[model samples]
Target: MVEFGALPLFLCVMGLFSESLCFVTLEVEVGDNVTIWCRHELIVSGYIHWFKHTCGSAPLIIGCKQFFGSVPSQNCFFFNESERMVVSVQGENTSLTITAVNVSDTGLYYCSSTDLMRITFHETNYLRVKGSESRRQSESAGF
Candidate 1:
């Protein structure tokens, strides 16, 4: 038999070990196409959501239920063409592709798996969009 007081502590440690989430960062030049990928080890029966978070503003939901064939939300319509912001999902994996990236696209993006209420797994990716001045500086530095 286990000590009653230690049982709760053990469960908490187990929960921490079970929690699975990760993040990645990407840097891209303006007008370039980039793809952000998220994958999970366990099978997800819930929806996958994408969000964009800026420094001062609240996080905006870019897409929801994308793995279940749902379309992206209107707030995600940053590009003129609808297909420019696309989400593709496969078994245990999902990807968000942005075409012709601009300065406005620079921000933190999050991908999460949720049951439409609570998130199960979450990950954040920081996107840095290189501007013309940065490019010129790099060129001058012979980079």
Candidate 2:
């Protein structure tokens, strides 16, 4: 008893109700290690993308993972060539870890997925990396 023309609209409404977004703010000190975690729900065959955006800079794809059938998950970093950054996927959970985090790492990290229909943003993490004591003291003293 559903009108053909309204079926799309109904589905859109249902999707809106079923979708959820999570945001987290994190702070760390320089030389510290940090990890951002993301969980995907109801995704069977698709890809998860991790992006980073900083003030006055365009968003960049940092890492990605693909899942298809019985194939194992593959992880790669497009923007980060350094070994200090790593991306790993285990079941429905994925994490991006940064070693010896510094001020340049401060930015917004986003976790999104694509199912060939639309891109769904799952989480946003705002990372603030503070300098060490000596560095902070020197900068404040203008040394």
Candidate 3:
């Protein structure tokens, strides 16, 4: 697993090409868990990839799950069941779950699938993480 240390603020830019591209925006406070859902119509035959691409950083393959392939290999890559980042695929739906989200977790997540020699982009999500000002205030007030 790759770790991205403290980074600067991100500037998210998305270019629309076709109607098939799914774009979603989400907002969650720090320390909260967030789940991104990706739906695809293509029958998954090769590999399903979950990538996190920040503004200034290169795209990182945080999670992956392989389906029907000739070469026998691991089912998934990078994250396991207990990791903070987990990717689950069920039929035509796939989800990426991030637990205890923080400032650095903010970025544009992309879900894609590969079958044969073709790759299809399924969804793109822009996650915005808010600071825990309200949580701190509530703790100070002992609520």
Q: Which ranking of candidates, highest TM-score first?
A: 2, 3, 1
Residues 1-143 of candidate 2: C-alpha lDDT, one tens digit per residue: 45443344234334442222323678898999999998754257788777787756767888887766356676543343348777777777778899998788887787666676666665567787877764786699998
TM-score per prediction, in order, is 0.62, 0.69, 0.68
lDDT of each: 0.62, 0.69, 0.69
Model 1 off-target regions past 4 Å? 1-23, 41-44, 66-81, 133-143
Alpha carbon lDDT at 106, candidate 3: 84
Model 1 RMSD in Å is: 9.6
lDDT of 1 by residue, 6-45 (tens): 3432343344422123235689989999988876333534
| Count of backbone collisions within predicted model 1 | 0
Q: Of the pair 1 and 3, which is ahead by TM-score? A: 3
Best by TM-score: 2
Clashing residue pairs for model 1: none
**Model 3 TM-score, 2 decimals:** 0.68
* Residue 97 shift from truth in candidate 2, angstroms: 0.7
